[model samples]
Structure formats: C-alpha cells, structure tokens
Target: MRVDSRTLPLVPLLLGPVGALQLPLLGGSSSASQAPIAADKPLISSPLLQEQVKAENLMQRARQLYKIAELGEGEYNHPTRVIGSKGHLGTLDYIYSTLTNLGDYYTVSNQSFPAVTGNVFESRLVLGHTVPESATAMSLTPPTKHKEPVYGQLVAVANLGCDASDYPSDLDGAIAFISRGQCPFGTKSELAGKAGAVAAVIYNNEKGDMSGTLGTPSPDHVATFGLSDTDAAPFLEQLHKGEKVDGIAYVDAIVESISTTNIIAQTTGGDPDNCVMLGGHSDSVGEGPGINDDGSGSLTLLELATLLTEFRVNNCVRFAWWAAEEEGLLGSDYYVSVLTAAENKKIRLFMDYDMLASPNFAYQVYNATNALNPVGSEELRDLYVEFYEAHDLNYTFIPFDGRSDYDAFIRNGIPGGGIATGAEGVKTVTEQGMFGGVAGEWYDPCYHQLCDTVANLNLTAWEWNTKLVAHSIATYAKSFDGFPKRVEETSISSFAEEPKYHGPFLRQ
Candidate 1:
C-alpha cells in the first residue's frame, strides 16, 4: 500500500524498517549503543519490581508452552487449507491451552464475535484466449457449479494510464480488461461498472505479480474480477484490437461462519486507571499454521503475557492477541471501533510485534504518521537502543506504518511504536550482511504456508528477539514518564544511505 508522503516521517529518523541486531552483550557493553550504557534506573528497582519478578517467572513457563506447541504444530495438514475450512475450535483450543498455563495470575475469557462470510470465485480465459498457469479467485464471488466452458466478448479500458480518460463507450454485455494503475483494484472494478461492463479484469503493469483487494464494501455495487498481468494479457490484447472475446470467472465459493476474536488479557497492580497494550494477530491466511507469518508475533505476545501475568507496574499492561489481521486488520478494527471516548482516553500506548523472529529479518521500529519516527517516539527508540547497548546488541531505525493494533491507538491519537523482524521484499543486501540471508526471497518462506510450524522457528533469533521484546516492554512499562502531548515530525531520509553496518555480530 502506498502511504501518502505526509504520513511518513523522514528516513534517518527511522520508522517502519526492520532488521536483526547483534546479540549477547559483552560485559560493560550495551546491545543498543556503540559504547557501554546504563539505564537511569536499575532494571529491577523500577516501581514495577513485582512485575519484573513475575515476568522472569513467566519466561520459564513460556519454555514449556513452546515445547508443547512444538510437539503439536506441523504440516499434517497444509497451513492455509487447514484454516480455510475448520471451525475455530483448533485455534481457540490453542488459546485456551496457553491461558491454562498462566494459572490464576490473569483471567481468560472466551469472546466470540459475528463472522462475515465470503466466497472465492475464479475465472479463466482458456482455449481461445491464452490462460495463465495460475490465478486467484475473487474474494466475494459466489460458487460456480460448472467447470465447463463459458465465454463473452471483451472490453479493455485504461483505468489509469497516460490516456486513462478514454474509457470504452459501449461495454454493455462485454468483458472489460483494465490495466492496473494509480487507483485501487476496487476503484478499477467500480469504473468498469460505471462504464456498463459485465466481467472486469485488472492486470499488473509492473514486472512482478500484482495483488489487490476488490469488493471492499463501500456502498458500491460493482461486481468485478481481478487478474494478474500474465492472466489478462491475451484478452487485453484482443481488446486493444477492438475485438470481442470470451472468458470465465470460475469460482469455488464457501459459505460458512468464520468467527475471529481479539484476546485481551490484562495485568493488574499496574495503573489500571491507564494502560499499555502489546499486541499481535493470531489468525493466519488459510494456508499454514502461521508460526512465522504471525505465529512468531503471536508467540512473543503470549510469552510477554506470561511474563507480565502477576507483575505490578505503574500502569495496566494488556496483551492482545488479535484475529483476522490477514483480513485487513479486522479484529483490531472491531476493538478500536467499539471503545468509548472514555476508554479511548485511558489508553496510553499500543506496541505491536507483527513479525520478530525471522533469521532473515531486519530490525524496524514504527511511529505513526510520516515514515520517520516522531521525536517522542524517537526517545522511546533511544531507550530501546539503550537496552540493546546494555545487552551488547547492534540496531538501527527506519520509517513505519502503524499497520496493526497500534494503528487503532494512533487513529485515536494514542502513542505507539513497534518492532518487526521483517516481511516480504523489504530487506536489502546491506541488511543481508547484518542479518545474513538471500537478498530477495520472502522474509520467511513459511510465512503463510503449512510449514510455519514450531520446527520452522529460528530459535537463536527467536530467543534473542523475545528477550529484546521483553526488555523493551519491561523498560517502557517501568520508565515511560507519560504519553507525549504532541509529537513534532523529524526528517530522516539520509539515514537510509549510511552503509548499513555489518560487523562480526551481524548474521542472516
């Protein structure tokens, strides 16, 4: 998604970027800084001593949970396929089991929300129009009964090219081919509808495959289909010649109740009057166990929850395990939308941990609005750096998007920031030197695949990341003076050019 320039802060003041930092601090050396560092207050002397002790105990318990999850998670079923059809029982059971391990330290409630049902429909231009080897089914199309042949004349429109205004005049009862351009996939489809076209197909203009969402429900009535560049080439070419063509929108639709939830487990003794939220999503794409896609983040949050269960801090810390994040942050959206004005005011911060255990990942911290980290947020990042320095780790910062639960908090004007291991297509060769890995493949090949089970975890990175995350949380809870009343933006673009540091400690 293209964020407006106004929404991103400058580059040097790092925001949304991710990476792996050097670990295992040497004596007198800090993990976050180039030199030895010490916190203004001792890690244990903070007002949240009880909480720190509880957190340490929770870490031990987390080891056991990891062992259990490792034993039970695997590819007996393809990851995506497993989620696609199951009742939410398996997932809920996992949550229940995780909570059971926490004993009486915290309350565990089973909250269920209504499920929005949708179907997957696919179409192809075969025999006549050259068809690609693979295609995606539209998210909203109803099931199709026949796998047999179906055809229709074609209509191609340049939705947003140099001459996008030249829309086809007579497109009724004809298929429409539109080049993927400036507007959203939904917008292209809506345009096709406005032009009186039947089926709509959108193709990528860039070199790689293009993915997008359609039928996003905006009080818009545009029944349309999306296509990859490879899939639309044939029919699109025909339309370029002003010739009629035929195609199919094959669909394998599903009609079931898919319930998603956001687990909010609160810690007491901290200021219940105001709270901090640490979160990550639990649901994965209908592909794999999502161990890495989010299982890493999910597990980290769970571990954090376990650690903070009985701890006492200055304010309440709520660990939220969200569901349906892959579905465009649905679970979090619901949570935020439901909060009252009073409830909104009570929230002081939201820290998101989306992906934090990839061996191939880069370190990133996000601050809301403009890619650069806001000044107040930068101070928090500095504190994190101090933690790293105290532990002897290397780290960097970049621009960010509050694309998770923190987003809701930011939208409501709450302070927030987060760390990510990494995701598809962001890390570069410089990062590879520091983190160690291939330069261009997906951050975690198992991201949304069935292989995202326990065994797939990068334990070294996992342990280090979890520790880093814990340290960050513990510090923030104990030291944050108060939420910033206002944050001035900073420019950080030049920081991107610093020859990404890679020393003996960096690894892929």
Candidate 2:
C-alpha cells in the first residue's frame, strides 16, 4: 500500500452509517446457531488434506477471481477497483457470493466503516515559456490554483530543503526550487512556506517524475508540485547560469468523507476460543485495478476458504478482507479498536498476505524474528522459512515496519507475520541472484499505477505464494502445539510507533 496520512473524521461503524446500508449482506448468520461437531470424528485428517489444496487447484481458482476483477473494470469508466467505486463493490459481491454458496461450513458477515477519500481533479506545473512539461501533484496536497497565473522568480534551495536553514533569505517572493531527497515532500513544502515562499516545486533526484505524499498536512505548508529530472534540468541550468526563470504551478482537488465495508468470515467447526486469523486488504488505490497489489492476496484467501470446507479444522479460522488500507490502515484499525478484551484474547495469531505476485519478484517474509520481535512473532516467521527451505526455494526477509494491514494487529499487541513478493522497491544484486529478476528494476513496475492490470501479474510467484498461504492455513488450523500462548498482561505500549513514510525511493 502507498503512504497517505490525511486524517479526517472517521465515520461511525457500518451500524451507524446509511451509505453502507445499501451493500448486500452475504454469508451465514452468527456462529450461535452452528451445529456442534461429534467428538468421535477427527478434528482434521492429514490424508484427506493432501487430496485438497493442490497448487494447481488453488492457482486455477485465483485466475478465475482475477478474471472477475478484470470484468469489474468493464462496469466502471476508470480502469480501477478502488474502494467506494462500483468496480470494488462488484469484487466484494463476488467474494461474498462465492463463500455464501458453500452450504453451512462458514459464518460470514460484513463490517462496514467510514473513510475520507481524496482525488485530483486538475494539476499542472508550467515551468518555462511553454505549458508545463508533464507533471503530477503529490497525494493529499491542498487544492490551490492561481486564477491569473501568479508568477514568481525561481530560486533553488540548498541541501534539498531538508533542514530549516536550507531555505534562502531571498525566497520570500519566489518559488522555492527544492529537490526531492533526504525528507518527505510535506516537510520541504512546510519549510518553504515558513520561509515566506508563495509555493514550492520539488524536482526528483531520481529518473522519474515525483509522485509521493507530504506524509500529512501542517499549517506551515504551501501549494506543492512535483517534477521529473527531465522536466526540471533546463530550468536548473538557466538558474545556475544567473539567468532569471519564472513559472506557474496550479492544483485543484477534492477531499471528502465516504463509507466502506470490510468482510469477515469464520469457520463453524473448530475451537472458537483459539482462532487463527488471516487477512489482506480488499480495497485498491485509485490508480488501477490492483489485481496484483492485493487482488492476489485477497483471492488466495477466498480460494482457501472455499477449498477448506472439504475438510475440518481443529481450531477456528477467520478470514478478513479489509477496506481502505491504502488510506492509512483505517478499516483494520477500526476493527481492532472495537474489539472487546475477551475478543482480542480469542485471536491466537494474525497473518497478513499482500502483494504476493510482482512481475519482478523475490520471496519475502516479514522479519519478525530479527527486527520487530513481538512475543509469538518469531515462531510465525520461522514457519515460512521452514516452508521455503523444505521446498528448496529461495526466500529473504523484509523489516516488520507496519507498512501493510498487519500494522493494526501488531500495534494492538497481537503477534503477526506474513508474506509479500515486493512492491515499488527495487531488487538488489543478491536478490537477483536468488530470484533471477532484474537487479535495479521495481518488483512491480506497475505498482500503484493504471498499468497494474491482469497482464502485469507474475503467475509463477502467484502460484508459489498461494501454495505457501494454503500450507500456513492447513498447518495452524490443525494445531498450535509449539506456538506461544497468549499472555494476559501484554501491554499495547510495548510495540513502537509504526515506521514512518518509507516509500519505494526512500528505503534506507
């Protein structure tokens, strides 16, 4: 998911909101009506499990879901399945219908919540004599456009405008020429505004045009625009040669509070007090259909839920399809916030799956053992490592920085771990040697863009990761012998704050 920290008033739960009242409620009723299992039958038989959950079977089901998502885009004008849109709603319905048809094996319900949505209507940056070269506005930037093309003399700031002293004394009436590096776009723009500049233009230090967040809003912020190196080179050269350069930057946008829903399903069989929860975000960014970003993960869970009904689980398994995760983990946070102390204790461990298939892929496990070692997190991490080693496949570790939907669970003192292929971050030489993909290219070249369609998926990564997800469900759902037991006094304050704004280009 991308970093967008614009905080608006959260609308109440689905019970309080009328917009969510329109969505179809799928799945069986609560577990109170579930029939008791006979004690004579085995909780789960190993021989019966092998017959189901084959990789081929799972992959075929996943591909079918992908086709459903592809068809969802046909009903919408834009090529996206973003939350609160018709395309996303269609995807949600597909999940609900597929599970509800499984005859009484699972109990499902929809948990709705409110979110604030933002979209850019118009954004442009005219740098030189001609109309502005191609540019895009940063996410969550305030909508401000000059009615009369307000002009300012361009003045380059020192040190990429990361520090307060980088702003020049003469930048009062001019546009601050800040390069994107060392800090977030919000910080640079805020500092420029504090220095009395009318606006700020940040050019990328890398190859592409800048497209990122200012993290969150601040009072000391001006209208900010991002430009690529190719677009800003000539202007920088002219300014260095002591020639005056003037330009106009304009932005128009809309931010509003909206309502969305999260779908939660649980098994009717198994011990409810010792539940194993697994999940992924159901919503996508506004840019594309997000088939690979999380469609891969969400569908994997759906396929597993459908197939798991063929056998019985010893422990309860809950599947959650979170909403508005790209909007700063809102859906999951609300879900956790409302949990009673007993409900929180019932969850044994939570595993999250996101972006399981990137075109240029590396098998990545959440680094719970080494980096962010929560209580039972290490045992969860070792499960993936053991799975990869036993299969003779290569895998690496990614920091547990709380960048995905898992953030809410870990922050609430719930032990969590999961798998991810990769996102906008580039692959290293070592990762290339292990995974056989381009070293410097992004794992998903189409991440968070309009190009992240069905064609951009890596089927090999998708298949393998889906198999691992199945293995996790089957293994833990059957027993929790070696896993750590939940402690009553686990403090929520023990975990540190979720890591801040580590985007693709800003990885340290």
* Candidate No. with top lDDT: 2
Which regions of candidate 2 are displaced past 4 Å? 1-42, 45-51, 54-76, 126-136, 146-150, 153-198, 201-210, 214-222, 226-245, 489-491, 502-508
Which residue runs of candidate 1 sit more than 4 Å off their true CA positions? 1-87, 100-104, 107-111, 117-128, 133-135, 138-149, 158-169, 181-183, 190-198, 205-207, 215-238, 255-257, 367-377, 381-399, 486-508
Error of 1 at 31 (Å): 42
Locate the minimum summed-lDDT window of 10 residues in model 2: 1-10
lDDT of 2 by residue, 1-508 (tens): 1101222233212211212323332222421323343445555643355445455555565555454445445445456666766556766766765666665677766676776556666776777685656567766566663423346888899987989899999898778999887677888988998998877888888897566665446767777777788888988899899998887767776556778877778887888999999998877777777878788888888877877776778899999998877766777888888888888988888999999889899999999862455578889999999988988999999988867877777777788999999998899999999999899999999998877777777888887787788888878889999888887743466674535543222211
- What is the C-alpha lDDT profile of model 1 across 1-508, one tens digit per residue? 1111222121111111111111221122222212211223233232343233333333343343333333223433333312323312344345544554554444444344544445443345442445655445444433433533334566666546223364577666555667766555555666666566555655667655544445343322233444566666666666677666766544444534456555666653456656767788766655455666576777677766655543445666667777666655656767777777667656666777777766566665553333343334555555556665776665556545434555555555555677766665456777777667678766676665556656555665666667667766676566457545433212134223211111100000
What's the lDDT for all of these models? 0.52, 0.74
Scored by TM-score, the top model is: 2
